[model samples]
Target: MALELDGFAVLHRIGANRAAFEGISSEVAKVARSLLVKLLKDKRTGVDGVRAVRAALGAEPFALVVDGLTDAEIKSIAKRLDKHNPVLIDGDAATVRKLVGALADGSTEPASRPRAASRGNAKAPKSKKEPTAPKTIARVSFKSAGATRGR
Candidate 1:
């Protein structure tokens, strides 16, 4: 029977029929299921299957998949899906590996050598100025000569 569905359901159907999603670790599947469920609940059912899978696996699990699976197997799966739907590979293998390494190190920033100073070669130590005393203004007050001024 034909059914009109999209997103994860379509992926599940493909997996069931062609076994395209075989060899995916249970941990990765669990993460994918959770993400898919959230997406479905949010009414975001239009996401591409390949992109959703990549996002669900994230950098770490995607790296594991690349390391564990053969190129032919990966290509076979992509080819099957590509025939019927759009396939989007997020980044190159090197970029995915770099992201995995960054995640493992608990850092989100990409690794790069420290850059040399752009302008001044050496930075001078900043000097602290001594506090100055507050200046006081002189005030003059005159008393009235009362009755003596009239005399």
Candidate 2:
């Protein structure tokens, strides 16, 4: 009898195949697959949440199946990981450990605080000086200055 596997199962198999091609041990690949499945199954961290994890695993010197994770995404992932919030899955200590270990060398570092622009600090600061009344000018009549309506 043939066993039927779902889309995600197929994807995991593909990932395992790729890992084998890249010389990654089946055990590490299995751990990565399980971690990915856990993350995907979680309600909070869906497809978007998996992005950082995928990027970190697929980064240079590892180069797993998933690639093309941008620097911004990496930075955002690092930032999230740095927060150390227990409420979120990414912030969970165990998940983080798995993620770091899956990176092949645990070289992925948590990103520092984001830049001012990222933190929404781009708005100009409000002026401290009180508003002054508008300067008033004497009205000048256009007719007196030889300015006519028609040339």
Candidate 1 Cα lDDT to native: 0.47
Candidate 2: pairs in clash: none
lDDT of 1 by residue, 22-91 (tens): 6665654677555643443243332244345457667665555545544444434333333232222454
Question: Each candidate's lDDT (Cα)?
Answer: 0.47, 0.49
lDDT per residue for candidate 2 within 30-70, as digits (tens), equals: 76655654554455763345556656655552333222234
The candidate that achieves the highest lDDT relative to the unseen native structure = 2
Alpha-carbon TM-score of each model against the true structure: 0.29, 0.24
- Runs in model 2 deviating more than 4 A are 1-5, 12-67, 84-151
Q: How many residue pairs clash in each candidate?
A: 0, 0
